[model samples]
Target chain A: MIRRPGDAQFTAFVQDAWRPLYRSAYLLLGEHGAAEDLAQAALTKTYAAWGRVREPDAAYGYARTVLLNEARSLFRRTSWRRELPSDDLPEQTHEPDPSDRPAVLDALRLLPPRQRAVIVLRFYEDLDVERTADTLGCSPGTVKSQTSAALSKLRRLLGDAVLPEGALHD
Target chain B: MTERLSALLHDEALDVPVPAAPAEAIIAGGRRTRVRRRLGAGAVSAAAAAAVAAVCLMPSDGSGLRLAPDPAAASPLDPAGWAVSAGSTLYLGNGATAQLPDKVKSIYYTSAGTVVRTGTVAYTDAPDSAYALVGDDGRVHSLGLALGDRAPSTDPRLPYLAYAQRRGNTGHDAWDVVLRDVRSGDVAVSVPVDGSFTWGGWNAPPVALDGDHVYVGLDDATLDVDWRTGAVSTASHLPAARFPESTSGRVALENRSGQPVRVAEVSTGASVAELSPGGGPGEGPAAVSISPDGRFALLVPWRTCDDDNACVYDQPASEVLQLDGGRSATVDLGDQVGWTPDGRLIRVTGQGVDLCSPVTAVCDPTGIRLGEGPVKVGGNSYES
Candidate 1:
């Protein structure tokens, strides 16, 4: 193997960025095995281009972009296609239980790939419309529309007490 | 409610179980990638090595198979010479050549190197079609991509290969315009195409890379995608449905019948020059090719053949039209023609390749010949 001085730096980056990248991947993919595969693929691609990553501080951003791209690729699979959103909501009312995190996760899984991605990038990653659109490789208008659709689905899945109608405005 | 949902989402992400980071695996994969690019250092995969062996063992008389002695240091637009492929051998202009195991289908030029699309057959797109990059050092490195039949585009200044891939496995109309960096073999950007596909008879949409923007040909409109910023906009000035060839600031618009008719400004639909005469059927030329700088256009006229059963349309003649001045000069077209990076004209015949000056229409022989087989020139050779 060709050894470079950047190997140690990349190893350090892997240790630091792995969990956050994995968490983002998990949020986007909504499963452990797919999330792990997506995260590993992103990190592997990041390692391949490590020599071109000029700033060490920007490594996380690069890996995150790659992770999102990998998730987009995963969304093209047959199983992911089966998760496309339909007009009819689930029969059961997803009342917010004491542990509301599970309810939120369930609602997230019901969304289409692009809509789910919009939700994760906006609320979880704290990205605005333009930045989220850039990350998702779409326009700000698309980000806004997908965000609106995903929030509507989430509101219907979870009761109004957990997510009020006013939440749609923001 | 928004804050609560955000907090819950964060908590939900954090609540998931995590596994140990596979540092060794990632590092090893990176090392493999690095090794694959070091073709000059004699590091190649076993499959690529065997393919090289197969190419070397092909029948040749040791005539025009010379390898470029030094790595290319010239600008891509001002290439040292022309490159062409016959059977399995690539004849790099000026006595340098490289042989491949598969037949060369099409060739694309980039600042980093010359990329060739290879398949088992010459003119047919198959499932086994692969791409390889012939570096300036005269070494071929496999890109390891088998993108099925979708047309990919490259610019003379950029090192990225751009193409369109479907966004879903269920055969949806959505697509993502993907750009892969040639040097690193990593996907630099994947911009999702916001529009639906109405373009019939294509596996996916065709892409044309000019400077920073790649033009995707759709049925309703041509999408001007910025590879750097991932911005998608409509190139409303160009032709709406048919594919257009984009260069510096000019686009060659295809007519309703998918034949080249005129060159126009990409910003506005103003005509730069008429590629063909405006009246009557069968008046259009057989093929029209624009220069890399978008300053000149080559129109190869069709000729009548005595034999009906076995006939070809492209004659051994051409009219070189200067788009800026509206003046044209007739030149003798060889078997095939393409443009150099510096906007010079190149013609290839069974005898050899010739460098032609577009202004004077004078052809100068470069003394490159590959015995006997079908020859495909680079630049615009594969254009129809």
Candidate 2:
């Protein structure tokens, strides 16, 4: 059973969750600085609502929900412009060869925000269907359907050379 | 099968050096929230403060708001560090050394757009209006609340810095481009293009301005304009057989013949060199992007799979092509790699499906993956 989060509890919550939250924002926004702003905005909103939240254990989930929602909302309000200037490439001492990565990213960007969110939470976070559905505010069946559709599109855009062994089986 | 795909994607993660200010940023952001609340309370009357507080405290209906953990109580913005997550959240240092502006009014989409800022540094003031520039044909367009009476154009690229003006209408489809002060919205210069550029349409051209030259990349070719003199010149004529799509700073050209072809930068009809694609064009050009330094080109080759019409059931195979001066390398990304803006690291989507099971065959119907890194599946070297 989760208790109501008090001011002290809320402070502790922010301290523990800030790093992961920040990372999530960066992954979604793709810009370090912008990601920081988005994360902060989400955090501020969470702080304001701490008193009303029912399940304190679910606070992280609630905050994550807020962050994802904020990201999607920002995307919607901004009209989904795909191009952005690169301030600096993520610093890599050793440059790996570029393969199908660019194409994959491009295809991912083409997806609608909901579908994209589902994909990110499912794969990157490695969440199961139930958790993914819960996070996305959709049914597990919808998650299954979305995963199917997204993968099918990726396979079609990329070719067999990129496919892993037994990728198209079943 | 899922394991293999996971391994491949795991290999593609770019080992980015963590920024030095993650802890500081979290702490600082937390402190700022507290200070802002106090200041907000003091700045407004009791009634106003209560109203603002009520609005902030209201339970989110979960319509537009997604929930996440709070950071204010837990961490202060640490200097010398930054943090990124798969969930699209990022944290930066909040130390005095951190150079984040006091108030960031707006962020432009690309290098072409300008992020407008307002208010005095170190002191809160009224909200500042920011504008983003979009260019089409040969004229520039401004978007945001600041442009009172002016309309936006269809051009994809806008100058980083520009002046705007409203001139006499050229025709039903024609309009004049005027230079205006960004701060005051007063026109300082004006230029006219041949056609009327409409908004909310597909196949729009991307425009970029460098010094006096305005570069436009259209569906067919790239155009250059002397904004000062109102002269337009064709820099490169794209082959009609190839349909070009421009986004961000990169352009994608697909050949209808299905034969692998390369598009190289040409000067005055002279061929400079062909951009390499790791190996020979295997399945034609799937997608192409030029690096910011103009030294490298990134290519994703087209692939064929069993679930052609269906969604991705298992790991989709795609080839990543790296093109540098004379050498080309192909890195097998058992999956797709998303490119960052600078074109250095490719963000790989980690989600995979178990193709052996009919139930989980197509794991990602949304066709979206979240992760960032560089190409690592096949042995290929990237020039830093």
Candidate 3:
């Protein structure tokens, strides 16, 4: 073992980061099972690098970076790409058609994995462009371009009627 | 549309269920990755081992085979130097050599021993090809071909051959995984595998079996079949769809998504070296092969126009590194690099076929120089 972070501290980190991290993973990969694996893997990396992290408080951020790296690496693999969930929504019991999942979800699915990751980090996680770029290991300009491309593609797929000028903002 | 998209994603993400975090499993797995990596590097007595790092490399006796600064040779396929096998015949230079083992198609090298894959006509088209384990001591054991259209995977750590044999093609094609104990000539375990008969495509199930677990990769999921208990379970951390290669079930090469390949050696449990593709372009390795001793790595850097968007992987350079923190140096050379049963590396450079120190990357050029510009390395070159 390279770095031995205390068990209590590691457990505490997992307990706190589990939900949010897993949620981020799910948003990144769009699959529950994969999201869990990604979160677990990210946490594992965080634990391994715990001793190397200069700032103890920044461990969560370090873990998130690892998670993003794993997700991006996974994007390069065809087999992992196959693990993408269908644009299908959860089954509704007493509701309308399950096929009624929004066209935008399908558009998000159609977007490249990194672009989708950018969208999830930007909108879902509500992280700033800089933070998103940092997470993705890309320049802010690249992040903006990715965001512009992703939003343009999403808008094309969903149409202007569904998106107002400032509706995507916080 | 952006607002709607965000709202839909927000709603759908909430709908995505997060399974209970297996805290123990996560912790255990993390430790496993760490432990496996440590194990791969071999146990370090810390302060003491660091002291012994020096004086590790001395001039060698060449272990019955040594190449000098530059050895001369004529043909790359010249069998006069080392034994080469063609079909059922072995060659000693251009002349007919001793007959190869029965049903022998080609010979390959593993960290443990020489692996001879056998079948008749055009190299074993009889459903699957079997292997003959020729021990370093020169004892030969022939393991009959399995049922499927693929050969068995030998466990580098043990003398076991794991293969999936055909059982039925009716309904869903059924296959059974067989683990043969090569020395005893005994079937260690024969367990039936789930899923239809595979036609052997990209999505075909991977048959990586050993004494412990038989990894059965199906389209929907990948499974670990316990050969001993016959218990099948979902492989954790491992993508159920892709069956990664494991050296000891502890450390494995996860044929990951991106180009920088990953080796899942338990560094602490879940932490293995996830090689990041850094450096400008071809400077990063396009392909990486780890030595069985876990001491060295053969890194084939991404080459030529491969860095550009058009990408041509015509790079013919492979480097040997002492990745395990030993006194090994990075030996760089032309393409076609492999390992001998013993840990020596074999490289077919334009100069000649050379034996290299895995750690020092220094090549002791064998006299077997290649005159044929650049010829493909045959399976026989695996032996030193």
- Per-model lDDT: 0.65, 0.36, 0.51
Ordered list by DockQ, greatest first: 1, 3, 2
lDDT of 1 at B281: 20
Error of 2 at B377 (Å): 20
Q: Is the docking of candidate 3 incorrect, acceptable, medium or high quality?
A: incorrect
* RMSD after CA superposition, every candidate: 23.9, 25.8, 18.3
Candidate 1 C-alpha lDDT tens digits along B167-262: 877364667888777776777677776454533223567778888677876655677776656667777775443444588767655543333566
Best prediction by lDDT: 1
**Regions more than 4 Å wrong, model 3:** A1-170, B1-113, B118-148, B166-175, B181-186, B193-204, B209-211, B229-231, B249-257, B266-269, B279-283, B302-323, B326-328, B350-352, B366-384
Error of 1 at B199 (Å): 2.2
Give the alpha carbon lDDT tens digit for every residue of B1-384 in model 3. 355566777776666666776666667666765564344221211110001001111222223221222211111111122323434543222232343354455454333344566554222333445666555455565655443334356544455556665565544345566665665556656676555422222213456543356666544445566665566554553544343444433333333223444444422224334444432211245555655445555554432211111222233334454544533345555555655433556666554667667766678765554432213333221100
Q: Which candidate, 2 or 3, would have the higher DockQ against the true structure?
A: 3
- Chain A TM-score across all models, in listed order: 0.73, 0.54, 0.61
Best by TM-score: 1
- Each candidate structure's TM-score, on Cα atoms with residue i matched to residue i, is 0.53, 0.31, 0.44
The candidate that wins on DockQ is 1
Q: Arrange candidates, best TM-score first.
A: 1, 3, 2
